[model samples]
Target chain A: MTTTTATHRGFWYRHPNLRLAGLLSAPMAWLVVVYLGSLAALFITAFWQVDDFTGQIVRTFTLENFQLVFTTPAYLTTVARTLGIALLVTLLCLVIALPLSFFMARVASRRWQPLLIAMVLTPLWASYLVKVYAWRAMLQPESGVLAWLIGPLGLESPGYGFIGIVITLTYLWLPYMILPVYAGFTRLPGSMLDASSDLGAKGWRTFRSVIVPMIFPSVVAGSIFTFSLSLGDYITAQIVGGKLQMLGNVVQQTYVSNLPFAAAVSTIPVVIVLLYLAAVRRSGALENL
Target chain B: MSISRPTKLILTFLALLAFAFIYIPLIVILINSFSTNKSLTWPPSGFTTEWWGRAVDSEGVRDALLTSVIVASAATAVALILGILVSLVIARYRFFGRESISLLIVLPISLPGIVTGIALNNVFTSYLGGLTFLTLVVAHATFCIVVVYNNALARLRRLGGNVEEASADLGAGGWTTFRLVTFPLMKSAIIAGGLLAFGLSFDEIIVTTFTAGPGITTLPIWIYQNLFRPNQAPIVNVVAAALILVSIIPIYVAQRFSSDTNKGGGIL
Candidate 1:
């Protein structure tokens, strides 16, 4: 019986194409139909406009929504501010992540590495809103933990505003930056560092000339998360940003009432991220992600 | 690779500082959960378990928790099936557009959450009629696919096809080989992937915000709504504190499974 079953291959099993199709069809249909279709629909809707009186989306193709997004001073400022915030958050994460990741990857004993990585990763599983809320509590004007800590030092907490938003975002994304950079550090050969030192390079010189250049791809990979997350965050801004608004805030506010305009606003991040992805794809960072 | 003593000490101090930065707010959340102050002011005037008791009894909390569990389970189920299917093809066969398939899976997650959120929101409102429970599941599963895919793909690549071939050569049929060999080998990976996907879907807020219909409150949405209300702030803290404590289990379990394979670090 076993020999007969093994010798008699099913028709579907005899053909690799059929097998592949059987496995591939369901996932492909869902991804292409639901995900890609929606994205395409969103961008298409961006070119359309809304009627003034009926509060309805007009199907006619026009550049009015894009024009408003690009030409209006408020929208332009929001775009620039969002870009600036994303950049600042990325920079802050890189600064904090580098030494921390280096320590974990190189300096810590092998036994301690996994524990430290776990420490960094645990916060990621913590609820996002809860983390932001924690930051909100920490940044309360005169009576917050930060204020209390900095009070004796004569440095005031930056209250809830642009600075608060940057700090919170940096905190939220630091683990992402650390994990990739840590992986890069572990991948770096100790022989390379020894060779640099043996060639008479000082610590700073070796770090600048050898280390940073080698891990640049990892840095870029980490920056992708920091930049894009900050660019598209509204809740963080809502909780800690006080009066400041980013592109996501604009999108969220307008999406319900003026979807075409919101879709136009949404395109800003999409274009920026696509451009960023294209630029970094050459760096081989996409694979790291 | 030899570092000076001072430099090593400085690195250690900085690492400690970074850990503190990562953990301080969570510590604060824990403390505030017990604070008697209604507004959760720091340096609590007193300590009480009043909020914890209230949270245990809150109807809103119970309903939202149930909804979150259901949505996450449903999303994780869909993601596991889709992820396993895609990973099987990508790992077992070489094909055209393979890179594009990986890119398509990553795009849902790699893009900003708000972009994914608004894009799906637009489609649902205009074409699908309106956001509903199903829409929420679809949005979540779309992104959760990547988590499962990455874990499964890593395991499948490491596993290779030799075992399956050996099983077939021993007179097992195709389905029998898959069931006895491939399925058993990939079970741990699938569990790891499912746990991670569940955690992701459970905590998701941005996409949930856009995709969840009116009156369909998930845990994160519940936390968001009550976060600002004066009377609910303490209970919110209790819930958040409980979440931070409970989240450690799945993360630790997933870590154990992935580490057993020793293929990648922390499931990315």
Candidate 2:
């Protein structure tokens, strides 16, 4: 009885295309049309002008929004500041992640590596708002723990400003950096390190020659997360950035009143990331996704 | 392969420092939840359970928690179905755009989430009526699919086609082979992926902020609102400390399912 049903269904399944289509239809409809189409639709909206008086989108086509994004010094500064912060965060994460991930991947006892990785991952489950707010409390100029800890040392908390935003964001995204770099380090063969040092190379020399090149792609892979995440983050800036604003804050502020203009500013980060992704595609970093 | 003693010592010291940096804020949160001082003063003026008691009785916290659970569950369910379907297609069949599909799957996560949020917001507000609970689910499911796809795809690539072929040779139909054979093999990956998807959706704020309706409040959204208010800050800490505690089991279970062999694989 089952044999008969199997043979019957086998006739339709003989064609791989039909089977593929059957599997692909739902996901495709959801992803291609709903996800990609929405993105395309958004960019289309960016080409139109918003009516200033009515605060509504005007359907007529214009490049004025993009022009304003390019021409306006305030928007340009936001772009630079955002780009600067993203780069700094990525650099700091690399510096911190390399040493820690190296320890976990190579030096830690095999029995404990998984446990450490799990420990690293647990913080991710904590609420994002809570982490940012915790930082806000910690950097609270007068009453923050940071101030209390450092005041006797004749220093102050960076105190709810650009530096605070940097510290908070780096903390928030640290695990993302560590995970990939650790994975990269684990992939390294121990013999390669031995090979370099055996041939008269010192620690720093072998590290520069053997390790950095191998892990560069992974660093880029981690950067994709930290960079893009920082670019889009307005919440951290809102909480600890004092009066500082990023492109994200600008977009959020103008989203309702000037959708077209906000969309244009958003294109800056999107284009920059797309370009970065394209540059790193050769390294096969996208495959790491 | 081994470093000098000094280098090893330095690495270990830095590792400890990194762990401390990761954990201190969390400890502060745990402490602040019990702080008697409402203003979040340094060293905590006093310790009490009053905030935790208030949080337990708070109607808004309960309602927001329920909403977050519902949304995350729906998003996870959607992501699992779509992830499996997509993974099966790519893993089993050689289609025209096979390589590009992986890129497509990753696009949601690779793009800055704000871009994704506003893009979806654009579509929802422009054509699909105002943002609602469904829109939020859709936005979350988009990124959640990547975690599920990665887990399932890696497993499928490992499993290859032999078992499925053996089942087919024995006269098992596509549906029968899947139900009896492939599904069991893929179960762990799916569970790990689903937990990951659920976790992502549960804590997500940027995308949720854009797609959620005016009255809809997920826990993160609730935290964002309350953390900014002076009086509500302690209550928010209670909720956060509680969140960290409650979240451990799902993460532990997920770690068990996927195991350690995968090597630094992130679910999201």
User: How high is each candidate's TM-score?
Assistant: 0.97, 0.97
Cα deviation of B237, candidate 2, in Å:
0.9
lDDT of 1 by residue, B1-268 (tens): 9999899999999999999999999999999999988885787889999889999999999999999999999999999999999999999899889999999998998788988999999899888899899999999999999989988988888888999888878867767877898878888889988998999999999999999998999999999999889888899999999999978987799888875423423334
lDDT of 2 by residue, A23-59 (tens): 9999999999999998998898889988779877899
Query: Between which residue pairs do clashes occur in model 2?
Result: none
Q: Judge candidate 1 against the unseen true structure and give its global Cα lDDT, from 0 to 1.
A: 0.90
Best by DockQ: 2
RMSD of each: 1.6, 1.5
Candidate 1 docking DockQ: 0.71
Ten-residue region with minimum lDDT total, candidate 2 chain B: B259-268
